[model samples]
Target: MNKILLGGLAALALVAGIAPAAAQTVEFTVINNSSYDLHYFYTTPSNEDHWGDDLLGDSGVLEAGYQATATIGDGSDQCLYDFKFVMDNGAELIEPEIDICQLSSYTIND
Candidate 1:
């Protein structure tokens, strides 16, 4: 009985340790500062200049001062790269760029 209890505890600990971290969905409010309406695209750092499944293309036109939210992966190793925003007109931006390595502020919820 003692051995079984210990095994159960060990299994629980293993599950806790191995489970993927919670997904994080961050929102960015992008402003279209240019005179013309703009289209945007996003790609992971690994595919900086290439469009892949990870690439999030422009959803709609953005007028000046308009904002939109872009979602990106945020769980375990699968959640790679800091989220980025780019204009099809050739502009680039990254959300929480300063906080890229600051994981402590992130609340993990699964």
Candidate 2:
């Protein structure tokens, strides 16, 4: 397991907003184009105060050059969210204010 950067998640949590929703489950394909394996994935509603839980919890890591379909069923009406990606080397990457309802796929590249 990679060391999660609490500071990075904290920074992302500071930006908050409520967005209109179009669906109950925000489904999207995530492509890992980076060199490092993706150890963890997290999605938090933009209106929330903290990163709730790991979407990839206990399943497996998203290996490099591969993709996976992620379904977020947080039961929130907000569509906008902040995504946190933890690499195998303890690197943290964050994409803020992503409208999951409008996107079909998201890619993480080196």
Candidate 3:
């Protein structure tokens, strides 16, 4: 009886120690309405240790009035990330700020 109880307690402890593997997939649609060709960069917000290196680096030359779609990851975060778009001439086009959108709020559960 003692061995059985200990085994059950160990099993419970093992189960409790394991965290649930929550993942998220994000799809991004980028539109370039500016006259100049735009270059974009993506990075995880949590990546404070390495800024550009941690970025997904979805760089591209987007012509004016052109649109592109980018799909990224199975992340463990609660929401999706709104990738930061930077132009080749060192200008940012996103309004308000860089980390603006709340993509995680509308994330789809898998």
Could you estimate the TM-score for every candidate?
A: 0.38, 0.77, 0.48
RMSD to the hidden true structure, all candidates? 15.7, 8.8, 16.8
Q: Which stretches of candidate 2 lie over 4 Å from their true place?
A: 1-23
> Candidate 3's residue-wise lDDT over 1-110, tens digit each?
22432343344344434534554444455455666555554444443322322122333355556554434442434342334556656776432222323332211111
Model 1, runs deviating above 4 Å: 1-23, 46-59, 74-110
Q: If both were scored by TM-score, which would come out higher, candidate 1 or candidate 3?
A: 3
lDDT of 1: 0.39
Which 10 successive residues of model 2 have the least lDDT summed? 10-19
Ten-residue segment with the worst summed lDDT in candidate 3?
A: 101-110
Candidate 2 versus the native: TM-score?
A: 0.77
lDDT of 1 by residue, 5-39 (tens): 23433443444454456634333333455554444
Clashing pairs in 3: 79-104, 80-104
Per TM-score, the best of the predicted structures is: 2
* Native-to-model Cα distance after best TM-score fit, residue 6 in candidate 2, in Å: 26
Instruction: Tell me the RMSD of model 2 versus the true structure.
Output: 8.8
